[model samples]
Target: MRVLVTGGAGFIGANFVHQTVRERPDVHVTVLDALTYAGDEASLSDVASAITFVRGDITDSPLVDRLVGEADVVIHFAAESHNDNSLSDPWPFVHTNVVGTFTLLEAVRRHGVRYHHISTDEVYGDLELDDPAKFTDQTPYNPSSPYSSTKASSDLLVRAWVRSFGVQGTISNCSNNYGPYQHVEKFIPRQITNLIDGVRPKLYGTGQNVRDWIHVEDHNTAVWAIVERGQIGRTYLIGADGEVDNKSVVETLLELMGQPADAYDLVSDRPGHDMRYAIDASTLRSELGWTPQYGSFRDGLAATIDWYRANEGWWRPRKDATEAKYATMGR
Candidate 1:
């Protein structure tokens, strides 16, 4: 089988490509990536030769159309994914997440190919004060930030295409992912690098925001299952069923490193930060017979810390960039 993985040079996308090549030696994989700041080709260094890489944007209608026509399957993982970045400049997010998705959907419809969309649990917004926040396939979108709002809009576009054009496809909304090769700008890696550098990690608000955590490898495995055996026009929620309070996650990482809780500094929260996000994975489990294969929240935190400690060169430069950007914003 031939497949096209958009954003294949990014964190989760790269992981998916590596795993796909290792598991299915016969499958030919093509990657289309724009190599944005967050997407480092270095992440896929070990698996480079096994797959074809194209540096291109998803919104380039002709390029996407041609790639979609060539492959039997298309897995879209490209987007401007940082929440703070979205809050500061939403236009880029809309263009990549919403417009780019529409472009791909149109291409798929015209070409008649199987497609899979990688979405996030954040689109469901924060849970009510007294209610559980686990989002299901049927949950109404209540996005609280521009980043999630655009993702929600993109999800709607995919559903509309399916309903209108009978596009053969499936969707997976996953929780916060943490594992190797994640960009240092993300929360987990940013905090890990900061704390280890003798700098205080920044905690937004009271750090009470809660998010379900999944290892990238487990998330990629779930995606592979859906692409292979999932029913068309269905949405699956993928997660490790592990939820961690932001403060507690930071504290756990500190403990593993023999550092103190005060190793972090409390900063003003991002605008419209969702209080908590969660997801119900029962549908994915029953339909795909899939479950996570990773450490729990606490154990995952431990493992993540060790990874950052061992890969300083991979994260230090990004950490410096993050600090410079944050410093300029503060100024």
Candidate 2:
């Protein structure tokens, strides 16, 4: 099988490429990434010799069509996904998320290739911190930020294409992901790198926002399962049932890194922050017979910290700029 991974240099997509090369040596792999600030070729360094890597934008119809035509399957993971960045500027999100998906759908439809979409649980908006409900496949679309709204729009495009155009594809809306290769701009990596620099971690607002965290490896594993066995046109939710509040997450990081739990600073929160996000991954688990290997959030976090500590060279270059952006937002 020849697989095309869009945004394959980004955090989750890079990890997916690595896993495929490691476990499925017979499969030919081609990666298409824009190499944005969020996508780093260095993340795919170890597998550099194993796969074909193409640095290009997905919205380029000719490039996308040529690439999608050559692949047996295309896994779409590209997006402008930082909520804060989308809040400040939404055009990039719409172009990349919505228009890019449309471009891919058209190419896949023309080539008769199987396609899979990677999305997020943030598309369901937020559940109240006190709410007992979790996001399910049956959940309604209620995106809050420009990021989630555009993602929701892209997802709708895939569904419509599958129904009207008969494009063979599946979709998975996953929860928060944390692991190596993740940019320092994200929550888990940012705090881990801050503590590595002997800087206090910054908590936004009262730090009560909750997220369902899953290791990147587990999310990628589920993606592969869906690619192999999932029903076309069906949407799957991928999660590990790892839920942690922002405050507790910081404190846990402090404890794991041998610092006092309260050694972090509080900052103003971003606008349109969602209260909580949780995923019901029962479909991925029961229907596809998949389960998370990182069942414990702390254990997964510890492993992530170890990776950042052991590979400072990879994330160091981006640290200052990321913090400066957060500082401007007073977060």
Q: Number of the top candidate by TM-score?
A: 2
Instruction: Tell me the TM-score of each prediction against the true structure.
Output: 0.96, 0.99
> Candidate 1's residue-wise lDDT over 19-126, tens digit each?
999998999999999999988888788888899999999999999999999999999999889988987889989999999999999999999999999999999888
The pairs that clash in candidate 2 are none
Regions of model 1 farther than 4 Å from truth: none
Model 1 worst lDDT run, 10 consecutive residues: 125-134
Question: In model 1, how many backbone clashes occur?
Answer: 0
> Tens digits of per-residue lDDT for model 2 on 1-331?
9999999999999999999999999889999999999999999999999999999999999999999989999999999999999999999999999999999999999999999999999999999989999999999999999999999999999999999999999999999999999999999999999999999999989999999999999999999999999999999999999989999999999999999999999998889999999999998889999999986999999999999999999999999999998888888
Give the CA lDDT, 0 to 100, for residue 237 in model 1: 93
- TM-score of candidate 1 to 2 decimals: 0.96
TM-score of 2: 0.99
Consecutive 10-residue window with the lowest summed lDDT within model 2 = 322-331
